[model samples]
Target: MFSPQPQYNSPHNQGVVDGIISGCKSFCLQTSIHGFNHIAAPKRHWIERLLWLVAVATAVWGVVDISLGQWQRYRENPTVVTLEKDFRTWHYTMPAVTACVQNRTNQDKLQNAIKSRWNVTPESHPTKYLYYRRFVDVVTSSDLYHLEGYEEFANDPDLNVDLFELVVELMPEQRVKLSTAEQITTPPKWTPVMTEVGACYTVNSLAITDVALV
Candidate 1:
């Protein structure tokens, strides 16, 4: 992020600055002297004295300003540079963090509400809500997948009501332990129905509240 022209701390570097000023002064003096060559006699002391005085004044002003602590403030205060860096960072870095934190906040709020309503902690699990949102966004993207068939049944409240009935039926057996030491489980066969159901489950788990539609 280099600026086209120098601005901060100092306007110009010493090398080009002093050299150009000196060169200009020399050229002016030479031109003046050459002009006077045409004159039989001319008073040149006044012009030389004025130029020397102006140059000295400029040098003294620079020294005084540098001594007074104006230069270092710009040096020490990176806020201006940081402001630039932040502008760039926001353009590139902030959206992902924002989405993640937002999802986490919503998840926490939802979990708390569920606990308060149930008088018990709902099943404790780590759910990446942002990921679920991304998956849902992908599935719903019309250009990517029409997904129209899924959406027809996806919004059904009666389906959720029926599923909740199964949960209600199993509530009595909730306390029982199903794990047995010798048994192992393999992934279920990936049928089309299973894929749709799994996607729905993932989407639902991460949602702050279930949307019921018919």
Candidate 2:
């Protein structure tokens, strides 16, 4: 007579099956509890939300204000040139200024004025006028050429106010005329019609006596 065989899962297999069933039940229970808790949690009152929003905004504003203050501290002061026209002369003073690019623009404006006075244009003696541009850069870049405050200028034992005069006297047109041989032999030495006063003492607070220039 034949006997029926009995199959049984190994202990390791049984343990795995039991663990899977237990884990599924635990996961389901935890999910249900989590769902209920989330539903039961009290909603934030409108006033509380508004307060939180205000707090966040205030924090952001504080950060921005601090950043702006730091930036202002490190940033360079504006280069301001005050020009006054009295009688036949144009008197200009830059109380506090640097040799940065902004000041460079102010310098350009003065150069243009001089150029206009001399009637210097690309069409009229282009090569000759170009030399003035090169010469002006060389002369102004020197430390001695930067302008100081009026006080410093006045106190200087060796004050040359005449030299500070911004004037471009165009030499007689006949004098500037050069022959082909002279042009080839000499890289024409040029004198800048406009000159700058030496570097000035910088002050944090400058008075605006004339707002017209502003």
Candidate 3:
């Protein structure tokens, strides 16, 4: 007589398996993920399950496709620099030169302007005087400064002096020399540009009209 074979599908093993299935069903039913509940539903039809399977497969394919595309882009352009060597002689455009003034505004010029334009002095109109004095700083600074009382002045274009005009008028005249192989002495056309440090001047900028080596 042969020895009796041990039963793999015992009642205890079946109970443990049932518990796991129950837990999974409960989790699927309560889960927020779409189509999971339908897939796990006890009374779900074969057709419904097939449709959900297709939808899941499509979603996975889409994600994989996007991942592959990004990987391809990275492989193609791993670094930002692209280099090319040329042996032929070529004339290159001049680089832009930017100049910033240490003193953003002239206090004397500002005082005079205010006195002439608004007929107000620090003694007479302390609030206006202080606001105007701090105006450039406020405008240039990254931090927000309180402008509670000077809203009217800030809003009115006529009340406020032109920033570029103020910069030019107050800025001390400086001589700029440009020399080339031919001893070009033509003055560089300076264009007013607003920078983080207030009004600045740039030479050989695209904004300047008729840019030439001379």
Candidates in order have lDDT scores of 0.37, 0.41, 0.63
Residue-level lDDT of model 1, residues 1-214, one tens digit each, is 8769865755457777988977766665565533323222235576675665576567767889886675576688857745655443332211110011101113324434333433334344234333333333333222223455345446535333333322222221112122323342542221111122222111212222442111
Cα-based TM-score, every candidate? 0.16, 0.23, 0.38
lDDT of 1: 0.37
- List the RMSD of every prediction in angstroms: 24.2, 25.2, 11.2
lDDT of 2 by residue, 1-214 (tens): 9999998879999999999967755654466432322322348576665665566567768989998886775564422212222433533332332222212223445456446545565567788466555444433333344433233335444333232232222121112323332224543332222213432222222432221111
Query: Which candidate tops TM-score?
Result: 3
Return the clash pairs for model 3, or none.
none
Clash number for each model: 0, 10, 0
Model 1 misses residue 97 by how many Å? 36
Better lDDT candidate (1, 2):
2
Better of 1 and 2 by TM-score: 2
Clashing pairs in 1: none
